[model samples]
Target: MRAFVFPGQGSQAVGMGVAIADASAAAREVFQEVDEALGQNLSRLMADGPADELTLTQNAQPAIMANAIATLRMLEKDGGVRLAAKADYVAGHSLGEYTALCAAGTFDLPTTARLLRLRGQAMQAAVPVGEGAMAALLGVDRDRAETIAGAAVDSILAERGPPLVCTVANDNDPGQVVISGHRAAIERAVALAKEMGAKRALLLPVSAPFHCPLMIDAATAMEAALLDTDLSAPLVPLFCNVDAVAIADPGAIRVALVAQVTGIVRWRESVLAMQAAGVTQVVEFGGKVLAPMVKRTAPDLAAISIVSPAEVEAFAKTL
Candidate 1:
């Protein structure tokens, strides 16, 4: 069986949708629709980035989803590939979970884009600038990363200061994990990582500390927004990032979306679970970042990302 996957925030880059959008009207329509929904020239920001603006949480979230959906549109309209017929399941990393739901027909493109815009805004507003941070620990598993996070927070508490948030954000793969929380705690975690057997730890360039308790406000915002949004069951099951399990119910997807705001993105476990469920091939749309991670997590699965127009055509031919 084959699983269709979408990439997360870090996969975005300047000029991400240019090739595919230029290649197919379907792709262009997806971009146009998203621009209309968000009331911003997001397509222009994506195609000709001032670099920093496109990287903003609000812009990056919808832009990433737009690029992925546009790429999928190209595959469908020009390549004669339909997701429901070709894909056995769908999954994505972090914000890409909404992309998965979009692909599976749970939410329309406009709703998906607007939801992402609000999600980004909410998450950014959840913490003050420079007060929270995220760090990536290389060559360490989730357990080691968690222990380091605990120690980082404990050390801070030992100083008689009030408790600060420090927790694992993403269990990305076997050798790479991300930690998030207070800036000081994250810095402390990085300082302790090497001594704790991690090869290296470096802070990410994100504006907010995501997937930690510090994002509780963001989670509350999403819960409110999701409650009012129209949702339908997806065409296929989704391997959720927070739970690392396949679920198809719309209500469950809603709860997961809210919970994922401050929950560890168990990407490694999700990939393994997809493999265990008999997914032998994984097709990643929009960006190439997640393909390598998939391979790293599930060596037995064949994974490929279709980003460029040529890659899209090649992938469709294989279908």
Candidate 2:
């Protein structure tokens, strides 16, 4: 069995999807449809980024999805690869979940673009700038990371009123975990993680604390938006981030989508689950970010990252 995965944020770059779009009209249409849906030239922003603008939450979310979908389109049109027939399961990291759903036919490209635009806005507006932060703890196992996060939150609660949020946001791999919440709490967690035997702990450059209680407002906003949007059942089961299980029900998928806003992204467990389920190959679309994580989590599984036209052709030949 094989799983097709999509990448999340921090994977976008200038000139990401240009080659695929330039090579295939189907790929160009994907970019053009997304641009029309959002009422702006997002393809230009993606291909010729000013860096800061492309990095904005609103832009990055849909841009990453577009690149991934464009790559998928190229694979289908030129490489003779079809997702519904080839992939056994689909999953993604964070915002990449939307892209995975897109690939599985849960949502059309226009709907996915619009939904991601709203999701990015809601996530960004959940907390004030500079008030929330995220930090990565390296060389610390999940158990130690959890203890450090708990201690950081408890210490803040003991000293501060109205309690503050601080907890593990992502379990990226065995040795790397990310914590998110109030800036002070995250800073404390960073310090505590190092004292708890972490090799290093450093704050990330993200705009807001994600996958924590602070994103409740974002979750609520998503609930409303998702209710209004029409989502069909995905063609294949998705290994959800919140549960680390494969689910194909539309209603369950919606619930997971909303909960994932403030829920820890159990990426490591998700990969392990896919591996245990007999996924022999993991094909990562759009970017190379998730392939390394798949390698770190399950080295036995063949991981492929399809980016350029050559890589796409190479991957299709193997299929």
Candidate 3:
């Protein structure tokens, strides 16, 4: 069995999907539709970067979705591949969930693009700049990472510091977990990580701390937005980020999507679940990031990343 996965945020680059778009009209149409939906030429920003602007949450969210969907369309049109025919399941990291759903035909391209634009803006607006932060802890399991984060927050309260929050935002793998919350608490966690036996910890370059309680406002916004949007059942079950389980029901998908805003991304568990379900092959669309994580998390699976026409052609042959 095969599972198709989409990458989340940090996988985006200055010139993503250009070659594929240049080579396939199906890919270009995805980009063009996204631009029309968002009322901005995001493809231009993606191809010709003023890197800073392209990196903003609003831009990065839909831009990443566009790039991933374009790659999928390229694979389908140019390589004569079909996701529903070739893959047994679909899953994605954080924002990539929307992309996975879009690829599955649950949400049309335009609706997905607009929803992501709103999602990014809402998340960015949830917390004040510099007051929140995220950090990646290396060489620690999710359980230990959460304990360390709690220790950091406890230490702050012990000193009569303002009560702040610190929690593991993403359980990415056995070796890497990301924590997010108040800037002070997150910084404290990084400082205390090494002494607590974690190999290292460092702050991420993200503009907002995501997948934590600080994002409750974003979750609320998404709840409202999703209430008004049309969501069909996915062509395949999605192993969602928060639950780490496969869900085909639209209601469950909606709840998971909202809960994911303030819940830990159980990526390692999700991959394991897919493996347990007999997924022997994992194909990552548009970005190379997730394939390595899949390899590291589940070495028994054959993981492939297809971001160009040639890779698409080669992968299509296997199907």
Candidate 4:
């Protein structure tokens, strides 16, 4: 069986999806749809980047989703590869979850685009700039990373007052984990990780503390928006980031989407679960980020990432 995965934030860059859109009319239509839905020239921002403007959370969230969906369109229209026939399961990272759901027919492209826009705005507003941060710990397993994070939070709580929170945000792979929360606690975790023999621990260039208790306000915002949005059962089960399990129910999917704002992305465990479920190959759509993580998590499983039109055609040939 094959599982199709979509990349989350941090994988986006200037000029993303341009190649596919140039090569296929279907891809262009996808971009046009997203541009109309958001009521702005997002496609221009993605193709011709001022870098900083494209990197804003509000733009990047839906821009990444548009790129992924456009790539999927390329595969379908040009390559004759359909998800219902070729994929057994679908999963995505962070904001990419919206892309996966859109790909699986859970929501229409316009709805997904609007939802991500709101999600990005809500998450950005959840925490003010400079107050929260995220850090990645390299060469550390999940257990050690958790230990370091806990110690950092405890130390901060002893010295600082309440509302200072730090927690593991992502169990990305066997060798990498990301922590997020208050800026001071995140900085403290970085220093503590270095002292505890971690190879490297550095802060990410993100604007908000994602997947931490600090995002409770964002979660609440999403809850209200999702309640009004329409969601259907996906064509394939989704290995949710928050639970690391396959979910099919629309109501359950809604809850997971809301809770994922402050929940750890159990990517490592989700890959392991897919492997246990007999997924022989993992195909990553949109960006190349998750392919490497799948390789690290399950080396035996064939993993591939498709982004450009040439890559899409090449993958189609295999199908």
TM-score for each candidate, following the candidate numbering: 0.99, 0.97, 0.99, 0.98
lDDT of 2 by residue, 199-244 (tens): 9999998998999999999999999999998889999999999999
Model 2 accuracy (lDDT, Cα): 0.93
Tens-digit lDDT string for candidate 1 (75-183):
9989888899999999999999999999999999999999999999999999999999999999999999989999998999999779999999999999999999999
Poorest lDDT segment (10 consecutive residues) of candidate 3: 74-83
User: Which residue pairs collide, candidate 4?
Assistant: none
lDDT for model 4, please.
Answer: 0.93
Q: What is the lDDT of residue 182 in candidate 1?
A: 95
lDDT string for model 4 (6-116, tens) is 999897799988888889999999999999999999999999998898989999999999999999988998787789899999999989888999999999999999999
Off by over 4 Å in 1: none
- Write down the worst ten-residue block by lDDT for model 4: 156-165
| Residue-level lDDT tens digits of model 3 in 204-281 | 999999999999999999999999988899999999999899999999999999999999999999999999999999
Q: In model 4, state the lDDT of residue 78.
A: 78
lDDT of each: 0.94, 0.93, 0.94, 0.93
